[model samples]
Target: MKRRQIYFILVLIACNFTLGYAQNPFEVIEEPLPYSKKASSFTINIIGYNEDFVINEWQKYITDFSGLTYVTAVNKGVVEMESSGVVFPLLNDNKVNLYTRFAPNKTLTGVLLTVWVQKSDGTFFSSESSKKEAERIKDWLFEFQDKIRLLNTRIKYQQRF
Candidate 1:
């Protein structure tokens, strides 16, 4: 009876661990091309907002960017944005993929936003090419983060008022 009870407890613990791992939304799959091979990725969590709201805001921001043009929703939480023309000599055309994962809980209430860039061929820019274009990508991401922060602040302030 004692051995049986111990085995049962061990099985329960193992099952719990497996379920927790499976439910993690932020687990980055390295085998995927764009996700693991991205030249750069910016991840952030915006509190007090749902996944749909976060995705909508990102869509609006990307559409409003000077060179970026809204293409179409790849899926429910994934959006694809393309450049209007050749933005970089090395990468004739570039594309941005925005992926959002929402996790709402008592402590944290928001979505995880990941921005990835790829070349026209649907692969990450080479290291040499990325070195040349890093500055531009960094600048754009900085501006994008600032806009998100401002939007979050406004939402929180309005909620209080």
Candidate 2:
């Protein structure tokens, strides 16, 4: 009887660990960037460039990166938006929504990137599993900026020639 009880206790402990391990501990809450919708938004300026140019560059970058799709692209007047709302509501006008359907076996993740041309600032929101993923997005943005810089340099070089 003692041996049987010990075996049962071990099985219970194992089951608990398995269930806990199945769920991811890190979760991203849905909320807009800068905390509030009424608050002033931030900007990531590409000096000497207009809204159209920045939008084009971002589209190109998104295309080159696999697993990212343009869920929505709205350019109404001065505001611009790009996102895959099917997966999660990561960015609304004033809230950061959660993506609860994320699975460990899934290979693709969705992202939302918005830009306000008139203000010259943009918002980038996504559900990231780790700090590395956030850093990767930042690095990609830097790469996009580098591409714009190269293009500008070439234009300047050609004008000089």
The C-alpha lDDT values of all candidates are 0.53, 0.41
Residue ranges of candidate 1 with Cα displaced over 4 Å? 1-42, 66-108, 126-129, 155-161
- The digit string of per-residue lDDT tens for model 2 on 1-161 reads 99999999999999999988755422322333456443222223344565556556665654443213342334332434443322211222222211111111122222222222111133333323233434433454455567977987898999998
TM-score of each: 0.45, 0.41
Could you tell me the C-alpha RMSD of candidate 2 in Å?
17.4
| Model 2 vs. true fold: TM | 0.41
Per-residue lDDT of candidate 1, residues 122-144 (tens digit): 55543344655554554554565
Worst 10 residues of 2 by lDDT: 97-106
- lDDT for 130 in candidate 1 is 62
Reference-based TM-score, model 1 = 0.45
lDDT at 150 for candidate 1? 88
lDDT, residue 139, model 1? 52
Question: What's every prediction's RMSD, in angstroms?
Answer: 8.0, 17.4
